[model samples]
Target: MLFSGGKLDNQALLTNQAQKMADVPLMITFDGEWGLSMRLRGTPVFPKTWY
Candidate 1:
């Protein structure tokens, strides 16, 4: 999984990128341990697991 420009808040952009890889079997994945909001801006940040 790739996070362009450090962060990706646009789902459509991700979809568009995935669509571009139609021929290849892509497994789009992300680090959930940190949570999506942790990487995305303008969203409520989830508490860290250690917290």
Candidate 2:
């Protein structure tokens, strides 16, 4: 799996990148474990507890 780690926000850009990765089989993920608001603006942050 591949993680973007909050560096991507543009759909067109992501599409281009996915195309480039098409030759390889992998999964892409983002950092939302904290909250979407932490990575993306204008969204509400949900609280979570980590053990």
Candidate 3:
């Protein structure tokens, strides 16, 4: 699933929902150009060292 937002609360709910239905691999991708520090709450933030 894909989502774009800076709201922590909304992201939390989405993450919880994804966890409950853990049958599929949830690839949560986000763009941080505008500052991703806020949208990445309660979730693992990948390092940009590779790409």
lDDT of 2 by residue, 1-51 (tens): 444344445633775678787987546566677766667655566877789
lDDT of each: 0.63, 0.61, 0.68
Off by over 4 Å in 1: 4-9
Give the per-residue Cα lDDT of candidate 1 at 38.
61
lDDT of 2 at 38: 61
Encode model 1's per-residue lDDT on 1-51: one tens digit a residue.
Answer: 555323454855876778797887666665555777765655567778775
TM-scores for all candidates: the values are 0.48, 0.40, 0.49
Instruction: Give the per-residue lDDT digits (tens) of candidate 3, residues 1-51.
Output: 666765777876888889789987677776665456635565556655544
Q: Total clashing residue pairs per candidate? A: 0, 0, 0
The alpha-carbon lDDT assigned to residue 6 of candidate 2 equals 41
Model 3 — TM-score against the truth?
0.49
Candidate 3: which stretches are off by over 4 Å? 37-51
Candidate 2 weakest ten by summed lDDT: 3-12
